[model samples]
Target: MNKIELLELLHQEVVPALGCTEPVAVALSTATAAELVGGAIEKIEIIVNPSIYKNGMAVGIPGFKHVGLNYAAALGALLSNPKDKLQLFNKITDEISKKTIELIEKKLVIVTIDRSKEVLYIEAIIKTTEGTARCIIKNSHDNIFLIEKNGVLLSEQKELTILDNQLYKRLSDLKIEEIVRIIDSCTEEELLFMYDGVLMNTALADFGLSEQNKDGLGIAHSLKKLTKNDVLGDTLFSRIMVKVASASESRMSGCPYSAMSSAGSGNHGLTTIIPVVEFAKYMESEKIKLLRALAIAHTLNVYIKQFSGKLSATCGCGVAAATSASSAMVYLMNGSTNQMGKTIINMIANLTGMICDGGKIGCALKLATASNAAVMSAYLAYSDIVIPSSNGICASTPEDTVKNLGRVSKLGMQTTDKVILDIMLEKVMNNN
Candidate 1:
């Protein structure tokens, strides 16, 4: 891909999001449907595939303390402008929160799981005095595919397919060398947007470490305390882990800050961007060099997700996003492109089997682990230490190794995904 094409890809994938993408996508669909009907909402019904259902089960929504798909649907139906897209909760207020709670108590919103649909599917049907409206999102978050009003089809556009058919295909076909070349060819002016991500996520990390965010998981806070007392050294690895985990905690706990999401996930963005930013700061690298490293990180992130699907059983933060971050770290250290490839291989060998049960406060732990591993992988690759291709499921080349990891995620993990969901659902049922 050329410079312009590379910029287009970054613009499409690296954007701001509030809260976890799965539940936010649920709200987006409901908001669209509610706007289409244009009256008092009598009831709302949300249907999602198993992957969406599993992911939204325990995650917190932005601007509210409540958690689950029911609250998200009600909040969208009552007070959301569809045009805001993923940042729909930017204007949520205390009164709105109370009203959304009343709507939930009234039980006007119902959510169900459909096992037969695609992995990323959400359908919202809203009933109003005026009419009933339906909206559907598939393939990726924010890609609305169909809309209908009063039994008549109003509009239909498959935006995801259009991008996937052309740009995504080109992206998936490029080798590691070509990806590095594309990042090198871009001017610094075209890549400054990545620094915006650093600022946004740093805000989240600050929130997570603040005393007012008492409800957060406290992993980062505890790490900082340990470093202060000499229980843990204040090294680069610990700092990177704490910073990235803090941002993940804040996002998962509904901090209301917009995260610069990568490949449709806020946690992925935290894992991919913060580690590289911290490394550059420690190394005292030039601004242009930092931008180029970020370009490599974000590009490789999108390329890996092209194989892993938008949502999957595997933890994208650990396996896909961190792998990209490791490669970027190698680049920042003035390591060759060959060493960068080895860094990718090391990351895959380390974190390929980490499962993604759902999005919740506990995700902070996984983000911390992934961040530390990423730094270690980069260091090892810089020292010329790498996992041999003869090992299990590893290929001779980085591109082929990524393809192997994709196979494990897409084909080998189907049964594992179902069982994990079953266990989660069983717990919910027992609680009731």
Candidate 2:
């Protein structure tokens, strides 16, 4: 891709999002369907691809104090703004919550399994006083497909076809040396532009720490303890991750407000930001340096996910955040391009298999695992215990390892992703 193309890709990949992507996607689909009828909705019937179901099960919606597809569906009907894309359900208020609860009490939400096509489909039907509205999202989380009311088509599109040879596949085909050159040579202005990430992500941490929204992991508290106990703990970056993760926990558990999301997840954003920011603080790095590091980390994540796709069978945090952290660690250590390669290899070797069950408290465990691996891999790379190409799935060099990693993420784990989703869906259905 050329410079302009890369920039466009970056803009698309780094857009902001509210709540967890899964539930929000649910809300978007439902709200769009509800909007079609132009009246009070009475019932919602939702069918999801397995991965969507898995993610919806774990992550919480903002203001719902719950973590499943039901509340998300209700919130979509009560508060969704169809124009807001993935943020359609951002209008939740006290009155709305009460109304949503009343609807839920009526047992109005229904979620079903659809075992066809891609792993990221959500179809929502809203039955209202006027009639029924239906909306469908396919492939990507927020790509709305069909919308209908009273058996009449309200939108021209009925299905969203998955684009073959997506961006990640294209990026994976490039040489790592070319990518490193682009990252290293960027102007300070471009690099520092991403400082907005720090500001935005910090806001989330603060919100999560507030007494009103304290359901998720206490990342802020953890950071404070880490800082207080260890003299090195007072670094700005550590504080950032703690804050970011704490807020993510809150948001994932249903806190209101949006987060600056990378590739459709606030947690992914936190994973990218907190680790990079912490490393910067530890090094007392300059703003330009931090930006470059963050840029590299974020871009690396975007690049990896290009192959892994948006919603993957594996946890994207392990791939995106871990890769970003590894790159940031290299930048912090002032390690050369080769060291960067080593760090990436180490990260892939360590975290390529972390399953993404969904977005919930348990995701924090995956985040922590990936973040710790990033730090360790960075430290290891600096120490020169890099994995050789002779090993299983490892390339002869570090860059080759990245390609191998992408292959594993995109191709090798395909069935694993499906099987896991099927099992989870089966359990949900059996229990229901």
Candidate 3:
């Protein structure tokens, strides 16, 4: 991939998010529509795909106790800031929260299934004294394609172009060796920009650990108390898993801090980077080495997700995110592209079927387990002990293998995703 393409991809996918991307995207669209109306919003109507509704219905919006898309939509209108992107709640006030709750209680804020075929879609329409304003995001979490005010179009809706699809394939088409070579020769400007992932993600991990006992369920504290080395063996491994887990724990449980999410997921970003960053620090690796490793990790993550689609029945954290980290681990250990491929194969072979239940605190456990498994998978690959392609769901090459894994997630697991959503919604309706 060209440097320009890679940098643009990073700019598009890797950005800060305050909470789960689904709910956060809803908040962004809602806030944008509210601002477009240019007056007090009387009603907020949010229409989303089933997948978006499923994912956003339970995850917490940052800075609020409420854990649903309704709160996010209302707060978006109350705050009136769309430029914040996923960090839409950073400007929320107590008065806004009360007003948002009032709007929700009065049924002025509404959420419904879009009925359209979009998997990642959010349409927010806000009604004010002046008129109604609308914003629509589709295909990507933050790609707002349509905007309107007072029943008039505000922007031309361009069709998704061939160049866009090429952008998606640019990373997917890169060989592991080619990726490593590019990272090895990357410019200082790129390296410095990439280092921000480490700093941004590490900040969340650090804050999570610091506030473990105070607000959250103390995922970091629990991991620390687990008599290190008993669960995963040794201090180094514990450090990596604990840091990744704690950051996830903090984010999942609503820590009110934004994370530098990769592939449009904050948890995925934390899962992919925290372990590698912690490992580089633990080993005191050179700055250049660490930056390259991070680049490779992100590249692999984005490539794998290309096939898996954005949200799937299979957990991207376990499959794509962990696979990326495992491969990066091989790189950090001075292993070859072949060894990194083996690591990817080994990790995907084991983690392919893990379910994505939702975005909640329990996700911390899943991410930590994946992080721990990535280390083990990398070690085994580095030692040339790999699962053969003949094994179940394992292919001869890394690219083919990732595509196969993608098939399992995208095509094979259709029923699984549907049932999971049904059960989740059923429980909610039954409770009501």
Candidate with the greatest TM-score versus the true structure: 1
- Using all chains and alpha carbons, the TM-scores for the candidates as numbered come to 0.97, 0.87, 0.96
Off by over 4 Å in 3: 161-164, 211-213, 228-234
lDDT of each: 0.88, 0.73, 0.84
Please give, for residues 104-133, the per-residue lDDT of candidate 3 as tens digits: 889998888764554687889899987999
Residue-level lDDT of model 1, residues 1-432, one tens digit each, is 677888898988898999999888899998999888888778899999988988889988878989999898888777658899989988688988887888789888999989787558999999989999999998888988899999999999855552366888898999988999888887789899988998998888888888888768678898888777566789899899889988988888888789999988889999999999999999899998999998899899988988776778999999999999999999999998989999999999999999999998899999999999999999999998999999987888889999999899989998998899899999989997
Alpha-carbon runs more than 4 Å astray in model 2: 149-169, 184-193, 209-213, 217-227, 230-244, 397-400, 410-432
The TM-score, computed over Cα atoms with residue i paired to residue i, of candidate 1 is 0.97
Best by lDDT: 1
Query: How many Å off is the CA of 390 in candidate 3?
Result: 1.0
TM-score of predicted structure 2: 0.87
* lDDT value for model 3: 0.84
Colliding pairs, model 1: none
- Model 3: colliding residue pairs: none
